[model samples]
Structure formats: structure tokens, C-alpha cells
Target: MTRSELIAQIKQKKSFLCVGLDTDLTKIPEHLLDEEDPIFTFNKAIIEATSDLCVAYKPNIAFYECYGLKGWESLQRTATILPKDCFSIADAKRGDIGNTSKMYAKAFFDPQVSGFDFDSITIAPYMGKDSVTPFFEFKDKWAIVLALTSNEGSADFQNIENAEGVQLFEQVLEKVNSWGSIENTMYVVGATRGEAFLKIREHAPDHFLLVPGVGAQGGSLSDVCQYGMNKDCGLLVNSTRNIIYASKGTDFAEQARIEAQKLQKEMQIELEKAGIC
Candidate 1:
């Protein structure tokens, strides 16, 4: 989706919520296991229940890759069923150089080749330019680069400063911005990094941010909006465990919708406060 299309959806829904489909077979309702494809079955239900409440859906790739072939099949089905109006993301934190990165791009952006086309993919910037630039080759697709992550170990590298005193994540935002326009590039800023959003905005005032680490991770939603929100409401705050795992019973989908509604209501208020609704 183009930046305008995305922004329109956020405004139309009065939300910037991105629901994470980090589906785990073991965690789903036992009754679903009886279905031919439990994962897709579960995802379809969640999508049907909450598609109107969210503007995006992110399927964490690792969750599917772990199951091998069957896992991939489930992912394909899930991708096929995703609402056309909602932005789709392959949360595949993939990074490689040259042809490898190109192939990764094709896998997610080229539906004819991989049967899984996503609006964007989470990319690790460790491999530098070559690793990330390949994704931008696909028109209208995005490269969501990892920056200040929520994980405790993120400080080990992302926080390291250079001789010029610029932190690694700061340098990443500066350099990556040069490779792509705000229309196609976004950074992964953890919601847990509340105050850090003040620093991040200094470098990327206009670029959209795909924020995770909210809900179950205990990141404050209000803090993220207060520090990170832009005029366009440039934020896609994701919630995984807290929504999807709200109930492990027959009412799982209903429970997921309730959880999503809660976030959507919060997001609507934020949009109103920012004068973007």
C-alpha cells in the first residue's frame, strides 16, 4: 500500500492498530486442532472478528517457518484470507546481501513466485544497505528496519555509540532514510522505548514507525503516542499475545475482538488528540 493509502485506512478506521498473528499451534484452542488446518482456521476467525478494528495484520514469519511445509501452507492460506483493505506484513526479520536479499524480497512481495505477498517485511539492518535496499525494489512495498528494539539485549549493539557520539540506532535512522523515501521506508521502534521516541522523532520526524512491544510486553500506549505520534498519525502499534491469547477456549475469536476493540478505542482517542481523525 502507498503511504496515502495507509494513512487513509488509519483515518477511516480511526485506528493505527496492527494485530500480530504470532500464532502458536500449542497455544490455540484445543478444539481448533481438530480442524484440517488449525492455524489458518484460527487466523480467519480473528481476522473476521477484528478486521474493522485494525488497519493492519502482521504474521510473524518465525511462527510459520518452525512448522516446516505445513506451517508454510497455513501461512499461504492466512495471507490469502487477509482483508484487502488492511495492510499485510510478513514479520520475517530477514537480512541478507545480494541475490539472497533479492530472493527474500520476491518471497514476500512477488505473489506469483512465493504465493505470499505482503505489503511489507521486517528487515534486520545488520547486513547494511544491500540487505535492506532489495526490498525497496518492489514498488509500494516497505522495508521496516529494526532499530531500537524492546528486547533487553538490544542495548548490546543498538545502543553502542560511535566516535562521533551518535548511537547505533540513531545512525541507522539517518543512513537508512537516505536510501528510501518516507513513502516506502519505516523503522521498528519498540513501544517500551517511550522517552527514546523523543530522540527518534528528531531523526525521523516524518517517517512511519512500526511499533511493537505493547500490551503483553507492558509498554505504555499513551507514552508511545505522546512521544512518537506525527501529524499523519504515523504509527502502527502491534499487540500479539495480549489479543490473540486473550482466551484459549471456544470464545477465543470473540475475546480477541474485545481486546482489539480496546486498543482501537485507545487509538481513536489518540488520533483525535492529534487532530488526524
Candidate 2:
């Protein structure tokens, strides 16, 4: 999706919500296990329930990779069923040597090769430009680079400062921006880093941010919008556990819709407040 198309979806839905499909087999409803493919079954229902309430869907690659072949089959089915109007993301934090990175890009962006054509994929930029640039080679696809993450150990490296006093993440923002345009590049900014958005905006005022760590992670929605929102409502706040795992019964999909609706309502208010809708 282009930037204009994405912005249009945000306005049309009155939301910038991105639902994470970190679907775990063990966590799904017990009844679903009886199905031929429980993971895709659960994902299909969840998508049917919440597609209108969200602008994007993110499937964390590890969740399926752990199951081997069956897991991969489930991911393929999930990818195929994703709503066309909603942006799809392969939440695979892949980054390696240039050649390997190209393969990774083909795996996600080349539908004929891997049966998965995501609108974007999460990338680890520690390997620098060559490792991260391959994904951008695919037209209209995005490279969502890891920057200020929400994990406890993120401070160990991302927060380290250089001799010039610029933090590692700050430098990452500056360097990565040069590799791609705002239309195709985005940063993974944890919602937990609320006030840090003020600093991030200085280096990336117009770029979109794929924000995680909200809902179950306890990050404040208001704080993220207050500091991070741009005129285009440049944010895709993701929630996984709090929505998909809302219940473990037959009403799981219904409950997920309820949870997603709650976030959508909150997002609508933020959009209105910012004059973005």
C-alpha cells in the first residue's frame, strides 16, 4: 500500500489500529483444536470479526515457524485470507547478509515464491543498509526497522550514546531514513516509550511508526498520540494478547471484536482531537 492509500484507510476506518496475530495453538479455544487447521481457523474468524475495526493485521512469523511444516501451511492460509483492504505485515524480524536478506524479502513479498505477500515486514537493522535494503526492492512494500523497542533489554544497545551524544536509536533513525523514503520506510517505536516520541519526531516528523506494546503491555494510548501523531495520523498501534486472547471459549471471536472495538473507539477520539479524521 502507498502512503496515501494507508492514510485513506486510517481516515475511512477512523482508526490506526493494527491487530497482531501472534496466534498460539495452546492459547486458542479448546474446541478449535478439533478443526483440521486450528490456527488458520482461529485467524479467519478473528479477521472476519475485526477487519472493519482495524487498518492492518500483523502475524508474528515465529508463532508459525515453531510448528514446522504444519505451521508454515497455517501461515500461508492466514496470509491468503487476510482482507485485501487491510495492510498485511509479516512480523518477521529478519536481517542477515545481503544474499540472505534478498531471500527473506522474496519469502514475504514474492507471493509466487512463498505464498505470502505482505505489505510490509519487520526488519532488524543491526546489520546496516545491505541487510535491510533488500526488502525495499519490492515496489510498494515496506521495511519496518526496529528502533526503540519495548523489551527490557533494549536499553543495553538502543540507548547507548555515541561521542557526539546522539543515542544509538537516534543515529539509527538518521541513517535508516537515508536508505528509503517515508513512503516505504517506517520505524518500530514501542508505545511504552511515550515521551520518547517527542525526540523521535525530531528526526522523523513525517514517517509512519509501527507502534507495539500497547493494551496488554500497559502502554498508554493517549500518551502515544499526544507525542507521536502527525497530520496523516502516522501510527499503527498494535494489540495482540489483549484482543485475540480475550477469551478461550466459543465466544473468543466475539470477544476479540469487542476488544478491537474498544481500541477503535479510542483511536477515533484521538483522530478527532488531532483533526486527522
User: In terms of lDDT, which candidate is strongest?
Assistant: 2
Q: Tell me the tens digit of each residue's lDDT in model 2 across 171-196.
A: 99999999999999999999886999
lDDT of 1 by residue, 1-277 (tens): 9999999999999999999999999899999999999999999999999999999999999999999999999999999999989999899999998689999999999989988789999999998998889999999999999989998888999999999899999999999999988989999999886999999999999999999999888799999999999999989999999889999999999999999999999999999988998
Name the lDDT of candidate 1. 0.94
* Poorest lDDT segment (10 consecutive residues) of candidate 2: 109-118
**Global Cα lDDT for candidate 2:** 0.95
Indicate the residue-level lDDT of 48 in model 2: 98
Model 2, which residues run further than 4 Å from truth? none
The lDDT per prediction is 0.94, 0.95
